[model samples]
Target: MRRKSLSTGDLARYCQVTPATIVNWIRAGKLDVYTTPGGQYRMELPKFIAFLEDNEFPIPEELQADRTRKILIVDDEEEILDLLVEVVEGSDANYIVRSEKNGYDALIAIGDFKPDIVSIDLNMPKMDGAELVRRLRSNPETKNAKILIVTGMIPTSDLVRKVKRIGVDSFMQKPIDIDEYAKALDKLATFKV
Candidate 1:
């Protein structure tokens, strides 16, 4: 378990200084601390962390936050799927990526992966992207996941309106322009960052 507070000894050990020095620093008001009933000095976690950071001290490993993002790609075309996987994985950002050939497999993957972003192709064999988007919007688990609709067909005004009403974040007409797709992913993932 992570410690909620640090003692003089703890700070001294972390700084490679004597316990007396910690007490001196506390007495001089250089470090924020509180006194216990038994006259023990205790530094709360936040203050200690701030002191370390403000002084350019290395933060402990356990205190560092994970910045990884998750992505799920749903498309029936094998070529498109492979290309997307390659592009997303090859990016500089931290992402855990998965690809599914159809919406059914995508749905199953989403249950476990709970991706932050879902890049979906509109037409597939078993279940289309439109139906998958509806399901995602309805589900509590994935309701907030960002959806980027990628389609080969020129959408009618009604189809565009329907998808927008269904809560897609953005759309890209495809022959899959690599640059535009990468830009879309960057924009979608930026919200979380």
Candidate 2:
């Protein structure tokens, strides 16, 4: 059956939850939704069905035991991107890390690479991290994709709150710690949804 876009009320009824709970899910990034030009939300039917079947949200799986997983790293700084590439290249964990200078290019790479995880920098030209997160969350294809915010900007508290609010799966601070980065990827690799 083809499913049309649903409103919050429709979602609440189908999910057997209160409207407030649905709103919380949206805020928590547990739900995938997009706002119209008039500011109304449209929910994807297939993902919603998957949520019902699994009783949990879906997220990308890890790279195979034998093959490297594809990862997209978005940042404007050449030096930082280069450093990240170097670190990933040195890791025991197999990963195909692709770097993009800005969010615009990152969006394009997202479609082309179909990465298992995305590490995004908060500050960038064209589109900032917040907007990029919003865009990723809005699109059904990328909505459940694992996202990690790696940024040097923003205070710690603010950064934590913002990332949580947007439903980012994980986060890391700049001056990239190789161990921590590895840990984050490890966690994402194992994450079921």
Candidate 3:
């Protein structure tokens, strides 16, 4: 899995140039990019890598593999959510995380965050993680985002079937083991498929 797209500043630092120079490259049609609503440019990972290869720039190790990745976590329980955040993002600066208490706001955040992986509780109020997974799968923009169910709910045969059809990438029981969580994230973040 690829990380989020690079900002002009991020790319500039990699290439040892000013952000203005990166923008000039974009303006001159030497590199391709998409602009956010805020008018900032983003260079997609694959395209940026291709650009570097074509131009003979050294691909930074971070861009090449095990780079900083985005993660989004959703749960309704405030205490549990805070604990999960503390555990997930506390020691690891490589993971940038965002959290929401409901599926609705999580959906809204997904539009901008474009998280590489989402760890969500299946029992969230209103839109539940199952439906959230369905909606994410249905969207072309987010269809491939990896979903990990981190919930206290015990898995039933029927429930397993339901989410299997919904296409979840992984699962973790609540009272999550930090090692297991880290391993799951490591597998999904860099896994090719």
TM-score of each: 0.65, 0.63, 0.68
Taking the tens digit of each residue's C-alpha lDDT, what string does model 3 give over 1-193?
5557989998899779999999899999998999999999998887886677556677676675745677898999999788777766764547888999999999999999988788888888889888899899998767767888888877875665587788999988878887788788777776543
Q: Any runs in candidate 3 off by more than 4 Å, and if so which?
A: 1-62
Sliding window of 10 residues with minimal summed lDDT for model 1: 59-68
lDDT of 2: 0.77
Give lDDT for model 1.
Answer: 0.84
Q: TM-score for model 2?
A: 0.63
Worst 10 residues of 2 by lDDT: 57-66
Instruction: Between candidates 2 and 3, name the one with more favorable lDDT.
Output: 3
The count of residue-pair clashes in candidate 3 stands at: 0
Per-residue C-alpha lDDT of model 2 across residues 15-122, encoded as one tens digit per residue: 667999998988998878998899877787645655553564333222123334678888899998888777777877877889999999999889878777888998
Error (Å) of candidate 3 at residue 135 is 0.5
**Candidate 2 lDDT score at position 23:** 89
Local distance difference test scores for all models? 0.84, 0.77, 0.82
